[model samples]
Target: MIMKYAILSQTKDLMPTLGLGTWQAPPDVIENVVYNALELGYRHIDTAFNYNNEQAIGNAIKKWLNDGKGTRKDIFITTKLPHVGNRASDVKKFLELQLKMLQLDYVDLYLIHVSFGFHCDPEKFTPLVKPTGEYELDMETDHIATWKKMEECQKEGLIHNLGLSNFNEIQIAKIIKEATIKPQVLQVELHAYFQQLKLRKFCEENDIIVTAYAPLGSPGAKDHFVNKYNYSPDTFPDLLGHPEVKAIADHHGKTTAQILLHFLVKQKITVIPKSTSENRLKENMDIYDFELTPEEMNSMKKLDKGEKGRIFNFLFWKGVENHPEYPFKLSDDKD
Candidate 1:
């Protein structure tokens, strides 16, 4: 049970830079993949309560930590808050459930997933079931209030750091303006297709660290954010197949994914690429030893064409569309 640790600025201190992404990853697959990644020196793992693998993830971490590779302190872990649990009063209850599922005392970083709110219609659906859900914003309570609850958890030692996911500038501004503690990190969708340079700049100026998911521009197809947002990863040539990427892979004797992960880390942006395979998990961790040149970095940066995407924008939580800060915008170049 060896742990991989890389320095990343979480708040005032450095945390492990690379973490395993568990979005949409199934429990059976994630268990082995996580263990393998840890064995390959990956200490940070990213999971969400919505991912439905919290218990499995908790089990894996518990086993690994107790197997003599190291203690929980040696690993940096993160889990996110679900959109349905966005109310101020419900935040702690949701977290407590996640903890019970995770079988852990605390999480390293806890994030508020989704910015504005949710949009849902349980009555008129193919799956037609359950209580109606609405935008947390339209409900009349403030996200800042919910965030305050998150901060209280931080004070209570339920989590080590507090961050946000799917939050936009105005909402982030509100949090920053009213927060007893400003958000330490932000995890967002970023890749060659949608670099989000402007958002990145704002976070950087505010001393907030960013973690880039969807680095390969995937989980974006016919349904979900990739489609609701109208982004096609297939539209962009796979970086793996690019001649420049190929040459670099040959030059460094690494794979394309390694090059991509390294590209982000070199820019000081933490990356959490999701893969449920043992080989891929280990391959991702093998990135720290290499460095790409300034010219090479610029070449990769040229890949931006402005597309926002994700595999799961299922909208099950309801009324997400009304939120001004919904991650994808109608005006974005959806072609």
Candidate 2:
């Protein structure tokens, strides 16, 4: 029997629970990754304007659509609004560029990539940095206004639904309370180690679909962050080496990554595991074949460290943590 899986958003859209993430996917390799993922039954493809691989993704999608593999409607495409384009007026402009790059007239979901805004050079779309070597932020950032613009895009058929990423529960609540069109989804870092139980429960009660970006604990996230942004490697934990996760994997005869993903899917959360390796890509989608016992679920739940387990705190952005809307505050339970 074919196992079916999906997460229904507030708009009643059926998003495939498993998706291929395109973050940090090199341009030279992304096209093939996209093609292979589509051929291997990945109907959900996640990309972002900042990923700089939309053109490559567009190429792959064009080829697949031309080959009659699937129609545009069969694929659920999600992209984000970059920090520079986080303003109310720049919303349509940035999405139009992404739509053009992705070779699509409309996207299935468009998200506000970050809560804070950046001062960018519109000509090159590069963010301006202050003399202190920090990103130049727009102190007048207004997410409510930005979200209203997103609603306009939806009404104009530029996008099917709206959502937010890297936003906190309070931020989401603010948007919901002030929004004419409620956010349909919320994308954030999620794994067994940092299950985000409180936020997940909030979204569940609010009818918002939650998507996990680093579902496998982002095994190499530490190295990547340290090398790229001068962050301390100690900020990230090794999820694959966790004793509880290893035991669970051994019991199920699966890799630790698969067990991590399976645990989240069991909670009805959508996940996007990014990998350029063909084997890993296939393995990421191979979780539906088995079910974790209730005891195994409880064991996974024990791994949660609440706010302390968060990896992408965005604190490396210098004064970004000081922003009023900064999401990853509180080094403990209050967050």
Best by TM-score: 2
| Superposed model 2: Cα runs more than 4 Å off | 1-4, 7-9
lDDT of 2 by residue, 1-335 (tens): 22345555556777888899988898799999999999999999999998999999999999999999989988999999998888898988899999999999999989999888788986889788788978887888899989999999999999998999999888999999999889888999998778888899999998898999888888767778899889877778899888888888998899988998888888888899999999999988889888888898898888887778888887667677666667777557633
Off by over 4 Å in 1: 1-11, 119-138, 219-237, 307-319, 333-335
- TM-score, each model? 0.84, 0.96
lDDT of 1 by residue, 1-335 (tens): 11233333444555676788887778887887777788888878899977889988888887887788888787888998876566687789879988887878888889997764432233321121235533344344367888899989988889888999977777788889998878888888777656778788998888888888777655422345455455554543455566777777888999988887788777778888888777777787788776788888898787666544333343544565665556555454532
Please report how far candidate 2 places residue 260 from its true position, in Å. 0.5
Q: What is residue 208's positional error in candidate 1, in angstroms?
A: 0.5
RMSD (Å) per prediction: 4.7, 1.7
